[model samples]
Target: MSLSTEHLLGIKYLNKQDIDLIFKTADHFKAVINRPIKKVPSLRDITIANLFFENSTRTKLSFELAEKRLSADVINFSASQSSVKKGETLIDTVNNILAMKVDIVVMRHPNVGAGVFLSKHVDAKIINAGDGTHEHPTQALLDSYSIREKLGSVKGKKIVIVGDVLHSRVALSNIFALQLQGAKVKVCGPTTLIPKHITSLGVEVETNLKKALEWCDVANVLRVQNERMAINYFPSTREYTQLFGINQEILDNLGKKIVIMHPGPINRGVEITSDVADSDQSIILNQVENGVAVRMAVIYLLAQQIKR
Candidate 1:
């Protein structure tokens, strides 16, 4: 399965065929990662620009590791250290990077459509590592790959994404992915964190944790962006835990055969309890492992879209 000649600006661009291709590619790489000497020369001589405007951990490291494994030149640009802090515009910075003949730009910005903007201006291909609460294409791909590997198939899975949906690009991207792969999806969070009336996205939205738990095959917990909170979204962390945290009680209540997941740097006893995150039912670590394979597939596939 080959990649099409289109920019991976969002998961919304992926149809069933594209999904299958990336998944297949990821499956190929999973074997590659398991080998003793993990290096792929597929992308030899390619230079990738890691343009991140937002603070990150998992996403950043995953991409760097992916590129290095593929034998690609990796240059990381942080907004705080760059001319963007010295009042340089996004376009000017992108043009400066492009002038160096980059092959692609893996970007994560604080605003929605930041990746789209770079895709429009840069000659290189654009891979959306993340763009605010808008989309995180690689993340969505890794998630889909994780589900496919673990469940054998994502079809007919009742996947529930819980916590901070309104400010979560992961939630938005994952919603598109799960629905595309034929999983039933519902988003659950407190009214303040979940926002109002987003059920129109072909998924149910709920505010009650117990009710959502009763109705899911996989329970996905999201991290709280305490740094990005705008207002008093929730009363307190204690109150949030009482209402939404995934403790041992919630895990037992969900019964067996329920898979748990969190996009990492998990707030441990916060959005999810230690038991659930460390449980046999938890696929959280799989998500991180697959993140590298998925990112490699994304960079390899997206780079092929460019005609040199």
Candidate 2:
């Protein structure tokens, strides 16, 4: 079975079957990556271009690694160093790349709908690495995959996405993906940081961290995006930490082990403490490992649609 949509622009575009297919595909790739000979020749004839209009560490490296693991020829582009600096349009840049016969475009951009826009105009397949504060589909896929790995399944799991709801692409994607797979989701943070229309997506809002933790079987903590904040959403960093940060003390008070997750570049003390992040309950590292396999599955499946 294949994904319903050709381009993975967002989780909102995917159905339950599509998600299941990705997870099933990832299970196979996960085992393949664990083997001594990690490389595969699945896409040896195909070429993929990674276009990053924004800065990334994990997502960028993860995609590059996934592409190489599948034996796809990879081209990496950074907007900061490219002609985008000289005011080149997105289409011109991509059209130029497509001229070189790139089969799939995995892109991360600061603008929302960048992937969707390219998919309409470009000949190649599209994968949205991230698009503004809109969505990060693969990240969400890997996140749900990690949850399933730890908890047996994503169905009926209670998940709380804590911190910076307004600015996080991860939070939005996770909400859509998790709900599609039968998990109940909640957003926990300061009222100002939480989007006003988020509850319309069928997720509840919890302002109190402790109560949110009590209600959730898993907490997917998000970092405080100071760079994305235009104004003071809360009084101060210390205040936000005091109210929303997850520490060992808070986990101990919960009386049950709730799985901890953080999509990386974590603020050590602002969103989660180092001890909690390093604890056995935290699957942050597993999420990173699963990221590679999940990405390989995505690229491999999309590459199947390419007519060689």
Candidate 3:
């Protein structure tokens, strides 16, 4: 259940057994952590810096907690409030930090392949917290953990990931992880939002919200990317709701067996209805909780590979 030191570049880097191993390892780690002594000597004296180019509440804090739980010193950097805003290039800023002899870099950049770029240029081990609609490997890992924990493994589960398919790194990552875990993955959204040939990744594509609703064991809704939406890719919020929103009508169409999930900072009535988000079947909260544990597992496991 252990990964190599090659770096978790993306979900494409991991297979089914590898993911299951992490989940199993996390489960065991949790049990061990419940004891009177919660600390682990595995990563003592390690240094992990969190470099975020974009704002995030869940992912940022999760990574920090993960490092602290392993007894590592944590340094945080933000693009807006840092020297990067003062005419420093990403590379130059990162080099300055790495000069301090940090053991690992956990980065979230708005640039695709930013993590991969840093890994190529740095001595310290790197984990991609996220990088611009390209991939969020840990989000996918935690989502997989959340799904498996809630539904008792993903094998044969008919899971439908709805909304902003093209813009969601979480969707892209989860599609790979979920498919690898033997689930029938489907992505549903309007034409502009859901790209063509996405099924080549081995997931089904659907545009009809109603049909996608009935076919799902889990409806994992996504947030609309207001930050990235330009040229008016969507007609309007009202129209988008009419076509793609996971509202009461969609919820009514979905059977009681279906579990609803949303990555947080939801757009409320647009992507998911508030009622469904707060319902018994909703694992949105669980995703947030599992996110911390999954990240902890990633940090705990990867810290051993840091060569510090």
Candidate 4:
């Protein structure tokens, strides 16, 4: 069995079966990575290109590592160093890269629908590493995979995504992915940072941090995207931290242990206090490890389509 869709452009494009299939594939890869010899010849004959129009550390490295683990030849592209700086078109850059006989293209771009647009114009299989504030499909998949690993299953779990939802591709992807797996989802942040019509996505909005934490089995804290914000969403960083930050004290008061997760480059005391982030309850490290295995599964499965 394989993914229902051709391109992993967004979680919104995937159905429950596709998600399950990816998880099942990831289960195999997870075991492989744990073994003495982590490398696999699964995509030995395939070539992949990693194109980033925006700066990235975690996502870019995860995809590169995944591709290498599967023994796929890899090419890394940065927009800043390329003709894109000279105002070259997206299609021209991709077409030039495709000339190298690449089988798959993993890309992160600053514009929403960049992946979708590329898919239409390019022959190589497309994977959206991230596309502006639209979606990060692999991140959401690994997130749900982590939840399932920690809690046995994603179904019936209450997940509250905390902070900066308006500027987050992760939030949107996670919302769709979690809901698809039958988990209850919520968005928590300042009203300015939270999209006004997010309720239309069937997620409840909770502005109060303690209340949101009290209601959730897992709190996936997001980074405050100061880079994306053109204006102040809140008065000050100190104020935001005081009101919304997750701390050890807040967890202790809850009476029940709730899993803490952060998609990294954490803002430390801003979205989450250091004590809470480094505490035993934080699966932040696990999330990072699972990212590689889950990404390997995605690349492997997508490569299978190329073989077929």
For candidate 1, give the lDDT.
Answer: 0.85
Looking at model 1, residue 287 earns an lDDT score of: 96
Candidate 2 residue 117 C-alpha distance from true site, Å? 1.0
Query: How many clashing residue pairs appear in each of the predictions shown?
Result: 0, 0, 0, 0
lDDT digits (tens) for residues 1-308 of candidate 1? 56754678998888877888888888777788889988889888699999989888999999999999889999999999888878899889988998898888888988899888877776878888888888987887788788888888999999899998888889989988888889999988887887565777888887889888888878889988787786878889988888899888767766666778898779988898888899898998999999998888878887776676
Task: Name model 3 segments beyond 4 Å from true.
Answer: 32-38
Q: Write the per-residue lDDT of candidate 2 for residues 1-308, one digit (tens) a residue.
A: 88888888999999999899999999999999999999899999999999998889999999999999999999999998999899999999999999998999999998988999999998989999999999999999999999999999999999999999999999999999999999999999999999999989999999999999999999999998888877889999999999999999999999999999999999998999999999999999999999999999999988888777
lDDT of 4 by residue, 249-274 (tens): 99999999999999888988899999
- TM for candidate 1 is 0.96
Model 4 residue runs over 4 Å out of place are none
Clashing pairs in 3: none
Score every model by TM-score: 0.96, 0.99, 0.95, 0.99
- Compute the lDDT of residue 225 as modeled in candidate 4: 94
Off by over 4 Å in 1: none
Question: What's the CA RMSD for each of the models?
Answer: 1.3, 0.6, 1.7, 0.8
